[model samples]
Target: MKRVALLVLPALLLAGCAAKEAEPASAGLTVTGRYPLEYAEQFTIDECAGGYSLVTIGEERYLVVPEDAPLPTGLEQDLTILQQPIENIYLVSTSVMDPIISIGALDSIALSGTQADGWYLRQAREAMENGEIAYAGRYSTPDYETILNADCGLAIENTMIYHTPEVKEQLERFGIPVLVERSSYEENPLARMEWVKLYGLLLGKKEQAEQQFAEAEQRIAPLADQPSTGKTVAFFSITSNGLATVRKGNDYVARMIEMAGGDYVFADLTDNGNNLATVNLSLENFYAGAKDADVLIYNSTIEGEVDSLAALLEKCPLLADCKAVQQGNVWCTAQSLFQQSMELPDLILDMNRVFTQENPPESELKFLTKIQ
Candidate 1:
């Protein structure tokens, strides 16, 4: 269960290969193929949800015409294929935004689920002001009129959208194709990064998508050789009610800590047969288990901001006695890190820097900062 173990698949390994040259055949032969998607496990190309591996380029099926958009040339009457060069998209998943940005496909996004003020990425903010990206309401309660007005060709949703099947159905009924993204389910951090390539294919920026993954892998490659420091770290947040919620052992955050040369204190805390990736504990139990951890990383995304060590202690004075607090090893991640999937490499490097004492005690960090 080492992060290094999942790094074996090189970034280029998932690049869709060119269609094989077809041999000369009888005059009446008609050839077709499906697009190949090598790495992503969440969804398949051209294959039924259960039966087959990815299909190559020419064989794609399940074509749906957008509302008022004309069908592309040469499409089979009953076959399904998205009209190429997807120009207008409604992005419901904030995490998927970074991947779309990485491939230079931001211009293609016409609608977003996040409000302008909630956007942390400057590009997303600017797009909103420029009138290029419009608010289309959240996934739970989308504005159907705005979506139809945008002439949305596609809507990329996260798994959470499943809770609102009526919303998804409504979009489809309006001629927008809805694709549910499951990248968060990937246990391996690198595999999660591989999902960028899938977005690249959809955005028609496959080359840039492959390049982004390649660069991310190159940045993480050296960490595989770093010696393990055997330090133990705890990553969690205290809820408003004082309940402690921690990531399951196999979650990407835990794997990232292990890759950065620290041992996750709760590495055995996962529910074996269930798909839950986090568990809640009483404050008393949290104090007992994490009191001796060498480092403690606050999950700011869920707990809101903890500006200082004093502030954290004020929230739960018992934490003042934890080893991490006593040794000044407490840190907090930025809220944006939770939605910025493309920053995984930087996140791992930040963890390694803290775990190995490679930087000054008060140095500013990219994704995390020392709790003052």
Candidate 2:
């Protein structure tokens, strides 16, 4: 038997049309006053004719074909729908979660992997509480079965799924499709924000996503021309082994630093497409590269305490004489950046505030409580 190719819907294309006007004539199937494809309706459409045609009514490019078309043998068929426009989604990554909530979908989320008290998580804490959203646990240990049983229409997972194929397979087995969000892997924060459209597509909220992204771009673009007279900054993630993993030149955080008018100390290193790159710096190498760093931002998993940085530096002797520490320019922010999925816009704004002197604080910043 000839194996039938599964009709694969390209996420980017679907994202573009999430909130588009309905087409009056979709082939012969008068789509009866088209509305955005609900979350469950989005995945119900299967490909036909060797995967050349699709059946759905949304912003995605789907084909209309005969209903009698043969489905590939042994392939599972299931139908799910987004009943409330995705008010309650389960977040497997925090990278883009804030951006999604910032765009007005906070109330729709049912649960999040990380706690609401974290810096980035605070962005949607009110909605989570008022809406009674649950916390299923950390990204590494989300309650997969509980999330599915909760009737979560969508699961926004990160590239880390590659590290756990069994989890991905299990979710698919349960008929809950996982959308791989790669914003955290994007080199530019603007590009990362552009991915907001992906969630919009899934939840029938593309227009909302586009408007939010446009406004964010407008706010950050002017900063590119703003002059900076301060010293450059460096951002690093401290591993369990106490190694300082420098973000590669192409990382989004590095780009955010540059956009906020601070030069990135590692902008010359190439990114390896993953959120991480191969720029392993030993104590001596780190001292040589960052000895004159004007500012240093370290990722801390602990909340409500500034002592983590001291402990980190005490363990790493090279950081003792760095200019940033010597001048008291070190700041300990949460490690939410590592897990961001759809929240890069707010992160960019936070960086802008921390790095730029001339920009006044927006009202939104008042509600953003730092983790310490």
Please give the lDDT score at residue 3 for candidate 2.
12
For model 1 the local lDDT of residue 176 reads 72
Q: What digit string (tens of lDDT, one per residue) describes model 2 on residues 195-214?
A: 66555554456689878767
Q: Which candidate gets the maximum TM-score versus the true structure?
A: 1
Relative to the true structure, candidate 1 reaches a TM of 0.81
Estimate, for each residue in 137-256, the C-alpha lDDT of model 1 and write its tens digit. 999999999887777877878877878889877876666767677777777788788888777766667799999988988898899988888889999998989889898898888999
* Number of the top-ranking candidate, with lDDT as the measure: 1
